[model samples]
Target: MTNRNIKAIKWFINTQLLGKWYNVAYATFKVTSKCNLKCTFCNPAYYSGTLEEGSTERLKKVIDNLRDSSVVVLSFEGGEPTTRPDILDLLGYAHDGSFYVMLTTNGYRLGDPSFLSKISERIDFLHYSIDEYHWNLKALDNLCKFREFGLKVNVQTVVTRYNINTLEDKVKKVRECGYKILLMPAVDYPDSKVKLEPDKEQFYQVLSYLKGKYGSTLNNSWGFIRALKGEFPKRLTSYAITIYPNGDLPYPDDINGEVIGNLSQNKLGELLNSYRAKELRRKMMENSARYEYLHLQTASFNSIKDLAEYAREMGKWAFTGKA
Candidate 1:
């Protein structure tokens, strides 16, 4: 079996059969918070360049920590990950590690052919963030250009109340380019005054319709589609975890969970098994219905059917390079 397949099987056994729910299936590593765009819907601390970035060596240490943990997929995120000077080195290091590496970016730096060429081989998947809020709608017109770099591009668009009607156009464009697009609802951060969360029912209807028309081209699984309407079966805190720029884990997640420990300072296995982490997980479970982290919500598999569907989708994308 492939190394990736082994990791996936181990994660499934640990989290599913063994009842070790905290075993993570995915890890979003916030490499840096230095982003060029100032999307109002985004949190400033993550994108305003306010958070100090770790050195290449320090970042590698955290990657090592995750390698020892049950993380199957390691996604590099940012204010904009490209903003970091040593991003290529970090990507290469993570790419060589055990996890399936993915890079999430705003497509700002991807305009450079040199940059794309360097990173294309380093990451297993490229998550291009584009939407009306980013003011880079024109980037969608050139989705085909990325295919030359030999990178599987997945366009991630934020669905909002204002732009819900325009989703079909974006999906149609993505379909024409033979690429997949992941649609996530616009979440209202705790500190943000502007409420951008879409009407739940309308959101579900639009996603369901798109899923029916496009199938796997629209990366929302049946379980995740139901989650759009707030029908989550249980909290998926252990399914995925988000790491800060400084290697600090925001416990179960970044949304409602607290920082239990730093991966750089301590091993991820130890921290996750700590009393503080256990207590926080219990506390978050009491209010599971209120968490708004779309990624975490999607990762929270509602049923075996949903989990199987998602696994098949990811397997195809990872092995065959098709959505």
Candidate 2:
């Protein structure tokens, strides 16, 4: 990574925290759970039967509520966001030029040049999911096809036991392919036996190595990277109300606060945050204990004077806060 990008990233992280944007910056909107491929690691029941989704008018109203929210970056995912009949209309709705619209695609349809031509006008970035469970390692070739359309292509590879050992090589290979690589370390499945989640040390080792080595290609913030590497901060599974085509998500899907709100009547913010602050106090505590050590040395960590004092003495290269 160049010195300029590093400075820019640090600046971005500071701006995000100072502005409270990254804390609530991005949201994952499930347009439709109807995916064409059935990968093993995927939960098919999440999006089965007749496709269900919010109409353009309804979704627009949902976006309206987010005005109080500075989350200008929106990631459209699904069972395959493109499957929605109104995909273009939905993209157009989000195309106010103020928001960064990203799509997490499996790349099956992207192989067709026509598809890129259609959506290239709308999306800012195209996030391609290529991992073991999705079984689309070869999708990189298809991804390269879209670059010509000028779609900023980023590949998300969820590193798992079956593939973690080879991730570095994969990153190298992905870089050679001319696309940014965002590494999503695999998470544990609550019901699974083998527990695909890697050991904490191993996870940190990989993240730390990457942060120091390919800091540029890793799309996640440096403070976040350091937080994971230095202390294995208890990760707060992101807060996004991922509604399926049926407009339902399993309770406790990922975060402390989330809900499948009926935007038709309910205020999206109130419905999601209706739970009292006390409800999340425990999770916040857990996160602090797990991750507070990583950001000790950064300017932002010290700048968090309102939050704490000792967070200053912490250490160099600590991942205590910020990203």
Candidate 3:
């Protein structure tokens, strides 16, 4: 590749393309598990999930293995990221000015203008969740108030059968609230009892409208659309890793997939290799119903193919209306 092309490729690898690469493009920093609200749909298990965090020193060791790539973004989430005592210090600790720092929050805290002012200084993008779990479409105002400093704010609305029909109107109103919006498919969470999966036709019809307005910025990608359409060819592995609060590593924490070694005691690269070498990877790869579901939501794999498959399954949909 030419110098310009190489730079362009690396940029994509760090951002949009990181999902496909084994390298860490996004780190969901679970600052702490203490949340301000307990949504009915959120599992108590995830909230009670491990509470350990890698210190700055250990975090740097994780970064060292990143090879020639820089971690493009580190997302701070909860219980409530703002609840963590080291919130500001952790923000300052990781601010190298190269990567973007973002947070996915519930907006109960952002209504305080004083806190908004402080957070706007370090966080690049602020994402607020609105869904059946969050149970309201009205928190957009709190996010919009931060516009004065040019802080990027985005909306994340998870779609379910209960709310799918109303998404269009909510989308327009949220757009007027002044931040970009993201339409997400509700994952198969236990508390939901899997009742929230949108009807396939209604879901796609919603996507038809979303794609019309937001283009590629609609959060869910075309591949995600294809998956919702049941075009998934075979099970896939995830390139992403989730190290819980207490430092235990779970293969696909979102779906309660499988457990791998903990980050505090074992390294990710070595653990992946050894786990697959034990014939466990083949068991999941060959197709067992239980493993297939686990693989879909959170599968542990030994190869890049696993990550690619997982990315296709646990696909992400995020967008900014930065104009």
Candidate that scores best on TM-score? 1
The residue-level lDDT of candidate 3 at 99 comes to 50
Steric collisions counted per model: 0, 7, 14
List TM-scores for all candidates, in order.
0.95, 0.72, 0.72
Off by over 4 Å in 2: 1-23, 45-52, 229-260, 267-278, 281-323
lDDT of 1 by residue, 1-323 (tens): 75666888887887777878777678899999888988868888887777767888889999988887788889999889998889999999888648888999998888789989999979999999989999999999988888898888899998888999999999999987778899888878878878888888998999899999999899777777776677765645547778999888897777777888888879988888889989988887777666555444445553667788887887887778767
Model 3: per-residue lDDT, tens digit, 1-323?
33323433464464344543233344565656777777655556546635555565554444333222333556667677777655666665555554557788887777777777777777777877876578555664344556676667667787777888777676665556455566765555545654666677778778877767755345444544554555443434433445555555565443544667655566655665664423545554454333322233222332335345434432232233342
- Better candidate number, 1 or 2, judged by TM-score: 1
TM-score of 2: 0.72
For model 2, residues 120-200, the per-residue Cα lDDT tens digits are 888877888888777777775444555568766677887666677877876775666456677765554445555565565
Task: State the displacement of the C-alpha of residue 11, model 1, in Å, after optimal TM-score superposition.
Answer: 0.8
Off by over 4 Å in 3: 1-21, 48-71, 190-194, 233-237, 254-256, 277-323
What is the lDDT, from 0 to 100, of the residue 90 in candidate 1?
A: 91
lDDT of each: 0.82, 0.55, 0.56
